[model samples]
Target: MTLLAGTWDGVYRTTGPRFDAAEQVLDCGRVLRVRQFDAFDGVFAATKSGLYHSTDDGDSWTDLDVPREEVYSVVGSPDGDRLYAGTHPAHLYVSESGEEREDDSRSWRELESFQDLPSREEWYTPRHRNEAHVRSLGAHLDVPERVIAGVEVGGVHVSDDRGETWEERKDGVHDDVHHVLVRGPDHYVASCGGGLYRTRDAGESWTRLDDSLDQTYFREAFAHDGVLYAAAARSSPGTWRGERGADAALFESVDDGDSFDVVEYPGHPEEVVLSWTVGDDTIVAGTNDGGVILRDGGEWVEGGRVEAGVAALCAL
Candidate 1:
């Protein structure tokens, strides 16, 4: 088994969710995403410099040659032959499939069509330069041909032809999408800068599902066994940096996101869980204060800690 984690400080790997056992595999810049692929027994980490991949557990890493300096997200095909990287300024790069990547370095090809998605002229970032970013990528495991890209401050884009072409869908969502969960060809839930949006009929339409929460600034969400979990703050990342912290908290929904209620845990009323993943039948989360928490058998407890906010987690 292999588990990889990304944090604002660096990227680390461990036997599982045990942070005490984690070893810093890379001392590079902020790690934003981590992906594990079984086909090559490979682990991939995205950071400020470029994309790095390790085929031999986390003992070694090779930086894939790509022009993008800030890689924010990554996803792999179930077969492990294909890989995709989403980066700053809202760009997507895909690896050439159906070949062994053991000795390949410049294996990624830029998909130029992504920049032509609808309202392409309207996407812009508020805090930085006048450019948006691809913050998250979701691939349909059940349907390998479909993929979704969540653009921060730009909305979500769906590709039925596996990254060759894309259709922009922002009907029930604000332009600022933080993460998108794709359960099927027609089912998806998007947690955005404005609120949470759900779609039962693919990308035809979406409905805001965050009416029960006081804050609309939602970034991440996950669903399992018909139960949906999400977190929210008074605003964006600004809340996590302040002294008081965003009135950040978690919530659960049994009605497929129609409504939600607070999900109690240790120190339930404080702190924000920014990243999540599942490990050995338990729900795992990382907080803004460099904390890792897990819910095993319905009880929540601390797993360990990092020195900065956890950006991503992957278990394989």
Candidate 2:
């Protein structure tokens, strides 16, 4: 399987043997997220400028005319036809069904009255209009009707009606949810600002599980096989005492999300750990500066080094 990574310098691609780099510099200032539409054949990258699609594996890219340029996440249907892009100020864009064009401005929907919902004030405190930043989106693996979204400064939002309506599912969850991962029916976990939290009741309630991870910015979480993995980055610590210990860490939980054991590394401690994907039993952890490493039986093996840093890793 091939993995795609987007960074400030450019876009990168990796397979079994070689690491290829596509110099798609972030002239627009920043690139928030990146994803491959179909395996490694096509990629969708979001930056301050706008959304871009690379069908030729980053050799060339085309701008996707999303409403807002500050897109943080993008997800395509399982078939890679229907595309959905989420951005700051709470905007959603749907591609013109089958049309994919650079200047093609499709119909866009803005979620404005979210704070008017019943649980708005309680769940989304300091309810600012553009603060409901949607960071991540995932289509349920088994359920087509359920669409999960992760919002910054706000808890998880579940849309059982296919993004038409959303409800705050933070009953037992802490605020400042950053990422969400769905494993099965009730097996789902969220990575919040404080740490990682898991809920068997979908998201009605949650229990914090970030004691082992020393991070105030839990960026992403993923599950493969029977193991659950989470990435923690020390962006802004609660106190200055923990500033010297600021480093990224990747944790693995074999018995679901109950407890975790640190996947030790030989180099410097990691910082800003991102997403990962598993192949066979080899778990790969993408970090801000430490490149990628393969978690073997009981050790972490160096995968390789990247000059632009790793954003997300997914197996095609």
RMSD of each: 2.1, 3.9
Q: Model 2: per-residue lDDT, tens digit, 120-164? A: 544333444536666777775466556677777667777765566
Model 2 per-residue lDDT at 140: 52
lDDT per residue for candidate 1 within 1-316, as digits (tens), equals 4566788877877787668778788877788777765544677888878888877777888887766878888888666666888998789998866533566565678889998887888889768488888888877667777778889878888888878999988777888888888777679989888998998777679988887678788878988777899988878876665566677778888998887887666544467777788877778888777778887777678888777778788776
Query: CA lDDT of each candidate?
Result: 0.79, 0.65
Candidate 1 regions exceeding 4 Å error are 37-40, 79-81, 98-103, 267-269
TM-score to native of every candidate shown = 0.92, 0.81
Instruction: Work out candidate 1's RMSD over C-alphas.
Output: 2.1
Q: Model 2 off-target regions past 4 Å?
A: 17-29, 37-41, 79-81, 99-107, 111-132, 211-216, 233-245, 266-270, 279-282
Error of 1 at 45 (Å): 1.4
